[model samples]
Target: MKHFAYISLCLALCLLFAGCTRTRISSFRVETPEAPEVEGVHAYMEPHSATYRFSGSVTISPKETMAVSGSYVNYSSDSLMQQSRSFSANGYYEFGGSDVNASFDWFGKASVMLIGFGVGYDDGIYHHLKVGFNTSVVEAGVYLGLYHQYTTLEINGSTCDTWPCSERDNWGSMSETNTDFYTNLFYGLYASIIIDDFFMSYNLSIYNPSVSGGGESVSSPDIYSHYIKGGYRISKHWEVNAGLIMSFVDPDYRHFAANVGAAFYL
Candidate 1:
């Protein structure tokens, strides 16, 4: 019953937006490299421009939910070691709960190939934040990002539902579908590629929250997610993307997701 409702919501959003976008990964080797000098399948590519992207996704795991994401990129320039920067926001909505995040990054400089900060929120409950850094080198025409995230989920509760399985306690005020609150420090990696009007990306991220309630610390197991997306430009300013997301806490708690979205260049 709960899964059905979430699925319905995700479908409705897809119909409403008919839009596209994907999460941007940091790569020290490239800042959207310049399109080939020759014209053909990759002629529409532009290396020194700005863009805004948006996407919608569905989580198919411990529970079902609808996730939406958007991002903004600043035009590349010669200043600050070939400067490139971007800001992004994303969220997931399920019955009785939601989780959202905002992040920013600046790259194109060797001394600081990748610098980023982000914040996470679960409706009006726990508060969370993270900071990270990464560097990458081009390999076989793709740029990979090597990064780390330090995250903290802080709230007054000693108990809450963390996902993997189900909640065991009736802990006061904890919604049946809220992301577990905890603090964690972990590393991850990412990759991206651009070919003319085509684009693709992949990411593997880590999350583990440690919390305290009743003077006792509640430690949740580590969570990992694998994400991949592909996109194609349909016009000078618009692109459509689709991908899969897999997340796991354990063999007993693994899930899959699919997403579709668009990107708009400015």
Candidate 2:
């Protein structure tokens, strides 16, 4: 009940925040003899063009606000046991970035998390565009990103227990696996800065609620996600990056990751 209330509140906030988002603002580019191109946080070259990069990251300490499996009390055996877990697998991502113009830059990232056994799997993508300005010490930008995550969950039995389990009554006499799939979309605002070989960026995203099963849609500001990162160039072709990424199942449920990765440029 508490979780449901929290989710309701968050959805309300998301709608409110989304209404405040401004349309993309256009600006004149700074003309130079040289055009700059970049891929992610690593490689930067002149005559800005399409940039390609490969990267790998590890998600550390992902908090599970909602359990992927189920559990219950078996009166037949007078025992308490857990069903199975489906969210223990590691998450991975593929990242890409490019300079759309002298004053505009765009970035894209795709991620996947799989737990096998047909238990759980998630695929997500994030895309952002920024208008930028530069100084001797830093390059700054105002950014907006759109993110979508598709998740599927499968659980076997234990339908009686509340939470961590699907809502159902089965008296432990009959049991079957249950599967559920859902999708979400989010919008974000961020500020990015680059200082020579080092860079730092952060974003705040709000959920964009939707209607399902003929239900009314919702609005929320409390429901949101966060991304923060820092990276440094090690060589002309290699770069190292680290960051924390956070997501929520609802206003009350969440997931978090501490990530470290490297980018190789073409």
Candidate 3:
């Protein structure tokens, strides 16, 4: 009951903050680089900006006995635009020294990341044209991270649960597709609220691709997956962020992770 209420409150705050944008602002970062006009590509980049980065996150998933991960994120705003980018990696290994560990530990260092570069437009809109990739010596693939934000919101949720989990077979297998590959390429809108250097960000994403035994195919409409991340700033260069990360897909994975990092000027 508390989880449900918290989610509702977060959504309300997001709606409230999203309406807090100014009709006419004095200035922004980055300039508009002219492009051939298109329907959904109406954004421009900002040049002068401040960039904040999170070093990495250590995550422990249910697949291996235990694993560790790291990530890098940069949030910046210039004279014309505000943009962000992130990259992450993880490695898992079995617990208790084992004689047959060599064959299994070989699958330790599997990772993926989103290299997102987008343009911020007027009226608090942005487009994320991102590049995603993963490689493990034998097999490798690439995909696009298509994301857009059209609103802002506030978030408040639980911080007590330390470890989250999914079903046994819900790692990343789709039931309605025939593709031998899997990746994260979600599209959605996000809302956030910032007050006195404290912020709450919530996002609702739609996974357009559903898979079966064969490959990826267009299927029925999915559910609204939720993500809420909030934190406090300790100084001009550092902040601590933590929250609940979950999904609403067939093979869903839920977990709690936090990051303590810094923001740098670029």
What Cα-based lDDT does every candidate model obtain? 0.36, 0.37, 0.29
Which 10-residue window in model 2 sums to the lowest lDDT?
26-35
Better of 2 and 3 by lDDT: 2
lDDT of 3 by residue, 1-266 (tens): 66456545644664666621111111111111111000110011122222323232222223222233333332211211223334342322121111110000001111332233343332123234423322221112122232222222111111111112112212221121121222323455444455665666555544432221111121222333455666665666555655443433234323232222222212
Using lDDT as the measure, which candidate wins? Answer: 2
For residues 224-249, write the lDDT of model 1, one tens digit per residue. 66667677878885667677766665
Instruction: Give the local distance difference test score of model 1.
Output: 0.36
Evaluate residue 262 in candidate 1 and report its C-alpha lDDT on the 0 to 100 scale: 47
* TM-score per model over all chains: 0.41, 0.43, 0.32
lDDT of 3 at 85: 35
The RMSD of every model to the true structure, in order and in angstroms, is 22.1, 18.4, 25.9
Model 2 lDDT per residue over 99-198, tens place: 1121122332222110100011113434444444433344333444443333322222212222223323232322222223334443445544667788
Runs in model 1 with CA error above 4 Å?
1-187
> Which 10 consecutive residues of model 3 have the lowest summed lDDT?
98-107
Clashes of 2: 11
